[model samples]
Target: MKKWIMLSFLLIYLAGCQPFMGGQAVIDWVDFIQWNGQEYNGVHNSEIADASFIEKEIGEVRFKVADNVSNPSYQLKDGDAAFHEKGTKLYSIKGKDNIIAVKDEAAINGYRIYFAMDNSKYKWHFDDVSLEQVKKIEIYKSATPAGNQQIATIEDKAGIENFLEILSNSKEAPAFQPNTSTGDPISYQIILYTDEPITYKYSVHYDGNTYFWYPSETAILSDDIQHFISEK
Candidate 1:
């Protein structure tokens, strides 16, 4: 068996820039692979409906392995994103209500992305996943940045403090003002905080979909947060 090792820091983000204090983050899409040659019917909840029998219930996420008759460690192709290094398989997953990106690179490498169910509060399980009837997976999109939207960054604590100070002083931060780009009034703020002994610093992220907030201990990834970032 070719044991897979995790890749760290696919992308990093600024903790201060995020708006939320504590919450879940979502991305647009994620990618994975299937060994067999197959086509997607674009069916709604096709995986979920099929695996209803062995479904493991978390708060909101329901997981069940369909059938693992196929071979393990099948290789997948990485597309334009350069997300996966060569010789990687990707796993993909989707959100029931909204399409959130999967941050797990292992799953992503195998063309699979894992989603967390906050409300369900139960950790998901894929211990006995079967890969039959599934084949030819493609990552049409990513949960992080799309074409027009950009993923910005911040580096040091002083930077975060300065950004926050600017927001507090000007009141022109996205949260208080109308964004000129999309013209959407800043609904929330994204706060990214690094390791600090005394004070907590933050930034303002005004993106339409995500309300990110990386705490003192966490790291900001390419919107995916969990799978794409590394904390030191």
Candidate 2:
């Protein structure tokens, strides 16, 4: 009787400590598919894939495994922007909700070029000067109380242009499956201000792999953009 009682207690303890015990547990999808071939043979059945048991035991386990996998670092190229200097403050206007003051010459020029190209008003603005003219560029968020949210800083004019081009091409879409551990989607708000007190707001979001913008239907972040943000 004592032996049976102890066995019951052991089982209870294991169940209570399942999370810790199953921390490293993972489901082999390839093996699972092979074994349950008939179930998923012809039709696209998500019953097993979206099962709560599978999510808790296997899906969550896969997420943990992915977390352990180290992502490759982004490589820097010959004209990539350097990290911003410490204590740099982003300027904000008094009455404007999203207006910001841009002092960096290169960033100012880049914005002008971006706006001109976006409106199709003046394609010749960039024709006069080469991208090599701009040495460095940086973007900062004006929403924070301290106004010190520096998003990205790039030194290569070509890199900045590429970034702008991506922004100009993105289009809006409905939300997709998010890959975050918290199960919440990641979002970004890019605010740009011009001397005319004009404000441009761009909304970007991450679907685990890449960052996409809504308006232009473009992917602003590729390997290079990822590297730039990560490096900073």
Largest TM-score belongs to which candidate? 2
Each model's total of backbone clashes: 41, 11
Whole-model lDDT, model 1: 0.26
Q: lDDT tens digits, residues 13-131, model 2?
A: 24655652334433222100111111111111001101111111111001121223122222222111112232322333344322222234333222111111112332122222233
| Local error of candidate 2 at residue 153 (angstroms) | 3.0
lDDT, model 2, position 38: 14
lDDT of candidate 1 over 1-232, digit per residue (tens): 7434221122222486674323322222222222222111111111221222222222221111122111122222212121223333223332342212222332222122222222322221111112222222111112334321223344444544444333333321233332357654232212232221111112223345432332222222233331212122
**lDDT (Cα, 0-100) at 30 in candidate 1:** 25
lDDT of residue 79 for candidate 2? 17
Top candidate by lDDT: 2
Residue 32, model 1: Cα distance from true site in angstroms: 30
lDDT of each: 0.26, 0.33
